[model samples]
Target: MPASHSSYDSGDEPRPRHVAIIMDGNGRWARARGLPRVAGHRQGVEAVRRTIKAAGEAGVEVLTLYSFSSENWRRPRAEVDELMGLLRRYLKSEIADLHGRNIRFRMIGERDGLAADILTLIDEAERMTGSNDAMTLVLALNYGGRQDIARAARNIAESVHRGLLRPEAVDDELFSSYLSTAGLPDPDLLIRTSGEKRISNFLLWQCAYAEMVFIDKFWPDFDADDLAAAMDEFAGRERRFGSTANGR
Candidate 1:
């Protein structure tokens, strides 16, 4: 189909260069199946692997996933432990494979809050795959949008106090550089699973103009086709970027 506006009407359909996802419904999937939530989480890991491959094949340059949120610490101790254990195992087993595939692995969030071992593994993964040029996979662990923005604000204030930056110099671009996702493009598309419509603190500032797609399938059941379908939906959108149809 032709683009709604001629401003960006190329021969090929519009595709999102950066896609962010909020993987939800794992607990619900497990509870409905009478299985422990951990089982659902494990299956969700498989879905993550599949989506990585699928996204790369689909020409997506950057993929960001909302994994463990900071609020997840409020869950029961035993469950949290299980989740951490799974994270550890995933890091250990998947890093080498991802590196071999020429994919860059990155994690964004509060590193101090993560266990020492996990932090070590994350550093290693980032270091090993730092030069990869195929695709970028970003996992948001222990992340909160509000916390990220607040941290950026604090850093900006510090810069001004130190005379390194003036209060008048702070603009949208300067403020975004202070964020954890500095140097990365804002997500062009955002997807949420399990029929959810809320953003749930995934990417508040970055997704200001992202096309939001919600799927009813639970996260554990998500696969390559679902991602492809979401892409198809994305290709059909006309991003005017606050411009009117006549302007485009």
Candidate 2:
């Protein structure tokens, strides 16, 4: 049976095969407890681990995480430096375990801004696990939906300028192929922690038909039960993709 075609509840509704998460509220989680922001970020890693295991258990085929946004560079210099160091450490320590779990790793974002060493590390990780089949874990670092769309548009324009693509032939599918997420399926469910109601410039076009799940739990505080709740809620939704609930 196909992944999305199965339902955990009675096999009636379609289960979300791909789930995208915007992990938010790290600073707030720290502030609420009078702890340093770094503490919250550290605990957030635990949440990531838990979420990954939970996703695997739920049979979700793809899990995309918005790790660091392009705008995050505007944060305090010290904090940004700390985050980079933490990311490097996490990558080094977790790659083996991720590969062992049959997780295909991929990073989505412009690579020019990253340090050459970090870029190489990311490349190595991608190359090492490109053939995994259990599940794919995509980390969106320094990513922005607007930037992705703009890049896709630029590519389309270049193709048209070179007479490779006719302007009249452009459509949704064609435009999407020019994006970084060209060969990936769109997220079936989008979850944002910290009760944030907005998409925050994360997958604007790809999430057009995704069921949204907003939770009040902070990223560090989120756990497997939280994921289950989100999945349950998603299973209850009627995703018509602009059509009626009856699939009309």
Candidate 3:
């Protein structure tokens, strides 16, 4: 099928190079099945595997997943410990497979907040996969978009104070260079699984024009076909980017 344009004109279909996702509803999925919440998290890991493979297959250059939010620490200590343990297990089990696929793995968030062992594993993963060229897999663990922006602002201020950068020269592009995702391209598409309609503090500044896709399927159940459907939907969008469809 040809692409759809809700605006004035349509031309070639758009292809998203980078995609970000907010994986939600694991607890709900577990509760619905009368299973423990940890079970839901385990299932979510499977979903992450499927989604990353799908993104790679679809020719997406970058994929960012909100694995754990900073606010997640407020949950019960047992759950927190379980989540961290699962993260370590995933890194240990998946790093070899991910390397085989030539995918670069990276994580963002406050390293100080992570357990020492987990932090070591995360650093090792990045170093091992740093040279891979196929695709980049970014995991936003213990991340919060607002916090990210705040940190960027703080960096920018420090630079200005040090006379490295003039406050007057700070534009969007300049400011973006101070962000954690400094060298990365903005996400072209943003997906939220488990039917959550809100962004929930994922990629706040970086996803300004990203085409949003919300899928009803729980994280564990969303697979390649679901990602393809989202891509198809994205390919049919018209990105104005402050200009008309016909390039006014």
lDDT (Cα atoms) of all candidates against the true structure: 0.90, 0.90, 0.87
lDDT of 1 by residue, 16-126 (tens): 899999999999999999999989999999999999988887778899999999899999998899889989999999999999989999999888778999999999999
TM per prediction:
0.94, 0.94, 0.93
lDDT by residue (169-240, candidate 2, tens digit) is 999999999887878999999999999899999999999999999999999999878887788898777778
Estimate the lDDT of model 1: 0.90
> Tell me, what's the RMSD of every candidate?
4.0, 3.3, 4.2
- lDDT, candidate 3, 1-248, per-residue tens: 21232211232456688989888889999999999999999999998988888788677889999999989999999999999999999999999999999999989877768888999999899999999989999999989899999999998888889999888999999888887887889999999988979999888999888899999988878887778788879887888887887887
Please say which candidate is ahead in lDDT: 1 or 3: 1
RMSD of 1: 4.0
Give candidate 1's total backbone clashes.
0
Worst lDDT run of 10 residues, candidate 2, spans 1-10
Per-residue lDDT value at 85 in model 1: 96
Worst 10 residues of 1 by lDDT: 1-10
